[model samples]
Target: MSESPSTRHPRELATAADPAWVDAFVVELRLLGVPGDEIGEHLVVLDTHLRESGEAVDEAFGDPREYARSLAPGGGPAAAVDRSTVAMAVLALVGVVLVPAALGAVLDGTRVTVTLGGVLAAVLLGGALAGLVLPGAPLLALLVRRRWVSFLLAPALVALGAGLVLLLPQVLVRVPAPLVLGAGAAAVLAGSVLLARAPADLVTAPGERASGGGGRLLGLLVLPVFALVACVPVLLVRLLG
Candidate 1:
């Protein structure tokens, strides 16, 4: 009698829980273009059904190729691409609009400096999308693919945004009050736009790779407070220096 995929090797699951296998499944799912929500739902279903059936973790996830086939059927990769473009577009919008606008307000110098930064961030964002996303179009074509890649992408953006947040105090402390307010305005605005375009699948959907549920909202609320609090350090730095 063959052991199930989940239970195939208890010893393996005991150590790393088969990170490579899970990652491969996630990568394949992304290639198929399943909606993030649906992917999460299916994973839950797979996990539950497999567990109930007495399958081990590794065994349970063994048939992701089959699951992927079941999802696409005759539609193939082209179908997946069509489904992905909208979300992709939204992502592009976040890069094109939000990033530059926020940076513009903060880094205003002569009109030249402001315009240049705006242009640079926008161009870089566009390039990142094209480089990271477009080439993978076939794989990313699915309606709701929930891959670690997609999930991880958001935080990378957030991390970039966070850098700006941390930088604001240093910049503001040295600048005039009007410039400080402008920087704050820009930071807040850019942050908001990034939040608005944040992919729901990445954060909200279960079984998808997410840092936390409600985390974006929590960040939304917390960032401003943190920014305000950061003023103390900025003031101190200025007063002392």
Candidate 2:
């Protein structure tokens, strides 16, 4: 008699699970903001079904990404970023802006001040960066569509951005070093607090994560980590120079 999926050794069940398909499904679910633990459970259940019926993933689920959209809490990924998370994102955005401002302040030998043009440049660039997000969706879609294209897409985008930076000149502005750093530190701290208070979006199981859901500490660490990354080089420059 064929063993039921539940009674089968876990190793057998795991072997039956299609890791590639599972990864694609998980990515779609994550983009839809499905909880981590719930995603893990769904993976297990899908694996069980696959074992029991001996069906292909494509046959069992028309498209994993579409299935994820259906599973979204409010029936879509549209409003997945709750208001509080958006607030956290804003603060994080501020942190991103300050990095370039601070770096421009240091590089131009205007450690105490930068021009208004610099700050304005950050703001304008932020909006442009937002536009690039649409391209990211296509990149994610390529996960299932054409994976090799994805492999090339990532580094190409990075290279393009780097090349653009070299072509553009830094705009100087009043880069009040202490004030900028202080506000940056404040923004990072505030963002961290918001992230902590932000609902635990990723309902990960004991040892499972839903895509990029790195849980609370990881969320909290993000701002400060980036802040340090921004500030450390300036500190190094000051110390040696």
Candidate 3:
């Protein structure tokens, strides 16, 4: 005989309790060789199923694991975003490659010009990738709980990466690369703040609303000064090296 919905387990009623867990779940699903689109679609379905089942924001788990059990017979939900893993993998590669390459390019000479242009390029690419991978980590969980705050960090990080890229040339040229690096670091730091207050429907938030909110304001207020101070050591070392 078939089991009733009420007799269903928590996996069947998965919620956002922690997006990071979802991320892990995604990774596990991938391990089982599920496609990306199917993963995303199933995620959407699972989310809806959970909400409908009366799951709250942060509930851990119920009697039986729903998704796991479902996999046993009906198979899991279909993938949502296609090649999402591939896209994320590419971004991760960008982060791994570009940062070092940018550093090398800047350090080509003792009197390197850490211009904004290069920094912007690196950060824009790097930040986005970071944002993508972040959902699978603890940070995503924290952000999911605080929708407003978490959502705020997403764009803030993007802008910060861009801003730093723009600032790099100026800083490395002797005016004080430390300040600029510090600014970039500050942006990253601000990301933490933003994460602490993320929303549930993160993708749905407006672009302006996501970034221009309190997190951006705070980042704007602090990054410049922080960048100046923080980047100094990095500059000195790069120059010396």
Candidate 4:
């Protein structure tokens, strides 16, 4: 982010003398994966310094982004984000790949068909989506951050592989349909529970959650959405069969 001079606020802003600098600093820290609470404490320190020194923020702090980096270079207490991202990836994998196989079995009176290419496609697509949600992963994250074509192209490539899995004769193993369905449903339920305990859901009070209402709404819909995904294949199978 570019550095710019900003006027100092007098006492009312509560965090820092320069609102612009303070905003940039907070944003940079969040992008670095610093936890929300820790960022608040850091702001208090900056405000205290500014009050004592009576100096222009730009003169004293140099640049907000640089200062934030110096304070939180490795990022503070974001294991939650990383863990949530992994849970999301697992949910994606089981929900997409296993459900379709189970559907194939129940609808066609066959065991759940599996292929090497299908598994790889599921993993890559799942990982890529997870990496987009939380940065710092290799390849996918870099591609997204840089606006590289991988962000646009990865899903298309995975789709191509999925189409080939249906067309080509490459059976890896056939899992019992009922067993696959049971296991996939259980895993998805477990992952949803973990997601419910994620940092976003840990926000204190109904009012605070309302502040991020869209995210909170999505969190509320998780169970129903998961149920819908599980039921979709069954509906498709019945309709098409």
Candidate 5:
């Protein structure tokens, strides 16, 4: 006799339904003002549907964001515009730009002038680009959860590398390190505050608890790795010069 679909392994069922898709759906629902309890109930129902019908989530419900918006009475295009998220992305970009410049200035014991043009370019171009990209970043992270570290670090490293390349000439000329460092620190702090206020559940699958020992250990290592990577340019410049 053939085994029943409900009797199949839960993990096997979960594997069939993409965890990233499920997580993104839950996040979208939450963003639309669905309470956590209701969201959890929805996910349970979704999982059962996926298991019983064996239909892909996209085929069954369409895009998670759009589906969630439809469920929310007034959550239309206006609901998508999260001012705080935009601000956080911009602040993060500014921090990435400033931190390296500050480090170079501090190392060289020179004062750096903050040009109006550079500030405008960084805020307008860099921040706008970041704002456009960040809303989708959590979804991307979930999609690549197996390589989460790389997914998280790649952008930061690229931004840091780019900033170093742009600021190298100025640093060599001895711009004030303290001033730059202060600005960078402020931007990072403000960005962090904004991020803390934003929804973080996009990275977590529905019904899954937060990571335990091994995951916590990995999370602890992320900061050190970030710091090490951020300092690479400064170290290279110091050594080569």
Candidate 6:
């Protein structure tokens, strides 16, 4: 006699316990342009089925993205982009780029010297390059489980920004404070604008979400905390030297 369907898929018993998989499924469905109410209904049904049957997601309905696509035909790779995703990306990028710059400026004050100006230019260039290469480094880092990369990115931005602030006083003739601050703010704003206009598909992935609340809070705090710790050494050097 053939084994029963549920008995045949004993491995699927674990599916009901894993909420991440369901979250990912809902995300993909949202990306495919499924209405919010419809998505919620689908999730409720799936959750009910999983609870009752104790089947692995793949065993019951196949891969989440594929399953969603099957249900919503034509909601494939070419689906219309969600504006909220783009807006979130823009806000995140702006925050990552501008926050550190603003902090650094506050620390450095208005005194500008030639050496400081040169350092500022180099740091700005480096930031520009990072923006070009990483584009949405902070947000991307948050989505994926690349802990080391994520940890490093925000600190690096802060360090560069702080370094620029430290150097700002060395120049004999300082650029106006307003210009420096304005430029940093404007650059980040422009970056946000560009990101907002990028193809939706490129900006957000199906099933992509920010990490948990604790992780996000930590991600935001890391830069400032690092900046504070880093300043200790700089302060000591200034005092001792």
Per-prediction TM-score:
0.38, 0.63, 0.27, 0.60, 0.53, 0.41
Q: Roughly what TM-score does model 5 have, to 2 decimal places?
A: 0.53
Top-lDDT candidate index: 4
Q: Which residue pairs show backbone clashes in model 2?
A: 37-203, 37-204, 114-173, 114-174, 114-175, 115-172, 115-173, 115-174, 116-173
**lDDT tens string, model 2, 38-68?**
7756766777788899988778876777776
The CA lDDT at 178 in model 5 is: 79
lDDT of 2 at 147: 68
Q: Give the range of the ten consecutive residues with the poorest summed lDDT in model 2.
A: 1-10
Better of 5 and 6 by TM-score: 5
Q: How close is candidate 2 to the true structure, as a TM-score?
A: 0.63
RMSD of each: 11.0, 6.8, 14.3, 8.1, 8.3, 11.3
Rank order (by TM-score, best first): 2, 4, 5, 6, 1, 3
Give the higher-TM-score candidate: 1 or 2: 2
Worst 10 residues of 1 by lDDT: 2-11
Model 6 earns a TM-score of 0.41
* Candidate 6 backbone collisions, by pair: 12-56, 112-171, 113-170, 113-171, 113-172, 114-171, 114-172
Off by over 4 Å in 3: 1-117, 120-128, 170-241
Clashes of 5: 8
Best by TM-score: 2
Q: For candidate 5, write residues 81-187 as lDDT tens digits.
A: 36876776666666666777677767777676555445544544564365344644453334343456666656865576457556643322434677667777777
Ranking by lDDT: 4, 2, 5, 6, 1, 3
**Candidate with more favorable, higher lDDT: 3 or 5:** 5
* Candidate 4 segments exceeding 4 Å error: 1-28, 42-67, 73-88, 126-135, 138-144, 147-151, 163-168, 201-220, 223-241
lDDT value, candidate 5, whole model: 0.58
* Tens digit per residue, CA lDDT, model 4, 1-241: 2133223221233444677677677666766666554565576666678889988788988887788778885533332347666776577567655665676687778898778767766666665666656554444435634566766676777677767667655888888999987777776676666665564422121112213435545654685476667677677867887
| Window of ten residues with lowest summed lDDT in model 4 | 201-210
